[model samples]
Target: MKYDMTLTEKQNLTAYLISIATITIGGSVYNFAISYFLLNETGSALYFSINLAISSITFLIITPFSGVLTDFLNRRNIIIYGEFILMLSILLLFIVTYFYGLSLFSIYIVTFIRSLFNAIVNNAFSASVSNMFHIDNLQKVLGLSSSIQSSATFLGPILGGLLFGISSFELVLFIFLLLSLISFLFDYSINFELFKKENISNNFITDSKINYFKKFLDEIKSGFKYLVSVPILSTVIFVGVFINFFNAGDMVLPEKMMINVLDFSPIQVGIVNGIMACGTVVAGIYLANTKKIENHLNVMRWGFIICAFITILIPIPIYLEKHFQFNFLYLSTILFVKFFVLALINVPFIRIIHEETEDYMKGRVFSGLGVISSAIIPIAFILYGFIYDLGFYFLPNIISAVIIILLSIIYFNPKKFI
Candidate 1:
């Protein structure tokens, strides 16, 4: 099938894919190292909760500005700057570990810095993609991007786990820094002029320089106003938010399950996650190649339904571990199945978001979505941590699944909103 993308478009897309893969590998490594380090050192759920809360707040506070900056500045330059900042933060992590010793507070500070840079870079990157690709092709590109990210997730942990096993945390941090530096070079090498268009005045930024926080608040208001004015877009955002809410458990539960229920070593946990990443890679490629499916809304609805149903089966490993005895192959199979279903839904959903949004609005819209989606993650993490502490693992998954199903029904029903 002819995909209707030009040679230049293909080149740009390929560059983006490469860049994403590079950065995602670094991100995955950092995530693995920080979580592992924090859990081992502090051994305090409160510290984890605190770190998450600080990072979430930082993201929320900076996202609006990041969106505005994407609109106001050269997005390519913004991304390069963000990468440099990330590199510095990673280096600081290494310094802290190697010289000052591993302090939880210092680690939390680095995490906050890392998350802030992530917010900026992500907004700029999304905006750049929206500008470079036509709407019809957006979904395919997003699918491919998701696949790349998932593949990185699969490999990054294995590398991180191995490195952590042999070397100190400082070594892992140094590797992260090196990867970020490489990503920066990639960002620098890209020709921004290739994607440049006439800069239209973003009325939102006229007063932004005068009072940054006030402007941020107004930009956020404008974003919400835009959403409200566009019912279809608003509905889409709401649906996306609900979907994220349900899937939030997937992020936290699997690690906890691996450690607590399955009693797997860190390496084994990484392997299982790597297998799940393989599933996501496959799903991403499939979605990228598939021709336009009829009724995207229907596809999305069914995707969420599938995800909800699959989530119900997530407890199978735990159940088997308890009753049927610990079987490595069985647990891995169950986890892989769960991740496979999630990837199936996630790729399509990502495509929809990329396809549906307009270029000018993409940054703000995505930032808004990020705010809503991630706003609750810290809370969910804390809640899940408490539940685990209370010896209740299955309830959170069940509740999340049911909530997703209900939200999907509401989101898919045209009569409800339209």
Candidate 2:
């Protein structure tokens, strides 16, 4: 019943990072393997797209409540239990696949449930970051977390592809199950309550059923109110929505161009994607080693602007493929720069939000931010998918670049921050 507050700040941060790294690695590999499995099983791009949309839809529907849960419930238990449930779900899937069979409906259901828990766990972890470590170490932790994530992204597809090619789908699921167990152990080691706020602790224990329901609604409303009350925060949310809509190309265009247009082998495509993720890794390292940024907003603003310019070059390889042999080097260089700039934009923005928001409000504020910023993404993905189907591979990048440039011009000014 006692809290584990024995670990020092450095130890806590290390445990937290290792925990995140393990989960991300497993999740990434599972994602890659599942995508391929679904495509091979269904042989329908439409079904694949629908499967993709499930996560976003789940985020929109469940994320609002998840924010409240993180704030009101025990954060450490939320993370630990959420992760446990995720692992259990996947284990169940593995057992079913091994004994009876795996159904598409089951896949969709598990994906939805896992997505819901992921939102809760992610909100808790993000909201707890400021409480877990000193404010001075916040950037370092964020930076290192980003590095872990980007490294996972880089490794997942390659490893997943190798495993899938050599092993069965059930085996991949079991591997992920094992990885999740490892992550759980690391997560259990963290003393999330070490810096816990007294009044915030055990919030749900004191509330009656009816009072808790009403209080949850009020908390959500207050979170939204606080988000809009801050001019820069609201502006950042708007900009996030705009950029994310266009940035959907980051997920779609790369595959469409590399695999569909340029006739890249699976290995070639993986290499290019890995190279882009490496750019993010480098940027994360740079941020982790640096001192506090005085004008994070300015840094973010220019980062977006630079990324927009880099995005415009994404389709050049496609255009030149008709005349000469398609060299991935050119496209890789462009993506490396683009991803690097994106990391710069993202890390500072997250740090700003964490630094500005009060501890009690961080969960809801971040959840509200997640909802608004992501609301446009599914639509954007559909639009880009439709456009790519029409053989307009270059159109998405051009459209994204122009819109991001215009939005940055209008919204991302130094004066706005002042």
Candidate 3:
């Protein structure tokens, strides 16, 4: 791989980093904002389950189309457009909350729109990153990007939590809206010439001439067919699906663990999540700078194993609290350790996905992963909720960990089904 960077490439890199940072901040805030609002208003696990299910469905529906558009359009322009739509969605949420009461139905509608934009924006961002860097450099770039995203993740929740604590949800929406506008501006300023040059070889004109709906269906089918042709890609998507399914448990588990088990406040819960984000930031930086780590598939396999270990270990604090009446410091320490391990594992897993897929197919591969992962997440969320209600909160993690471990073993063994 070439190491030389042109002036224009440097500019594009700067623009891409800023755009991603702004978008991550806006997106992270929206996620925390909606989940917090719904938890406060409906005060039911079932409502949270339903909200997640709807969001997953929205992503499932939009991701394939977004993936196709990523290939056909200028990547930077696609990202800018997605940011504008996301900004509009935030404004709509503000309008609904200001005029009408914070009704569950209203929140659901706003969140669904936001989720649609999120899917598009995410696909665009991933595709843009793939377009910007070479395959060999992808892992490092992805690690750096993940770090930036993790930094946003660290800030967004803390900001959202503080704003929600001090002012109304409407005020938080106003802040998110302002941030999104900045993001839109940043996105618009990015040059798409390099992306256009790279994609000129693609038959965009002929592809664009097809009927929209039929084209969408064909694109979706083509993405799946492409994945099937590549054994590694298929395995990677399956791994991602399982990883996301169990990871959804994290959203509901923290609240349950804090309130019911540790008897902590919302602020404490926010602190814990912030700590996890900080760990992510550290892992991202470490992975980005480490140049000699070339065995991405093996790295990913170990990441899964580590993540599963952390997942299974999470219930230890609860067990201690129940049987031995541990202090808050002890419990928090355990949770923080678990989060740190999770962060360490996730950075490599994501790097592998970014590095393995070809640049042209990145959009479809990631979006296809999104579609499959989203389809499974709804069921996972609902199932976790039900099992939580049944006093079996640990069961989901235990089952998911076992499944992941088995899959990882199979994935590592070349003789097994690749």
The residue pairs in collision within model 2 are none
Runs of candidate 2 with Cα error greater than 4 angstroms are: 1-7, 197-214, 321-326, 388-402
Question: For residues 168-225, what per-residue lDDT tens digits would candidate 2 score against the true structure?
Answer: 8888898889889988998888878666666445545565565876777887888899
Q: What is the lDDT of residue 207 in candidate 2?
A: 51
Question: lDDT per residue, candidate 3, 320-339, as tens digits?
Answer: 65632353455456556655
Per-candidate Cα lDDT values, in order, are 0.73, 0.80, 0.71
Measured with C-alpha atoms, the lDDT of residue 349 in candidate 1 is 56
Candidate with better TM-score, 2 vs 3: 2
lDDT of 2 at 63: 82
* lDDT: the better of candidates 1 and 2: 2
Clashes of 1: 0
Residue 20 in model 2: shift from native, Å?
A: 1.8
Query: Considering summed lDDT, which 10 consecutive residues are worst modelled in model 1?
Result: 320-329
Q: Candidate 1 on 137-206: residue-level lDDT in tens?
A: 7668767887888888777877787888888888887877777777777667665555445664666545
- Each candidate structure's TM-score, on Cα atoms with residue i matched to residue i, is 0.83, 0.89, 0.82
Which stretches of model 1 miss by more than 4 angstroms?
Answer: 41-50, 92-106, 168-170, 191-200, 203-210, 250-269, 316-337, 384-402, 414-418
Clashing pairs in 1: none
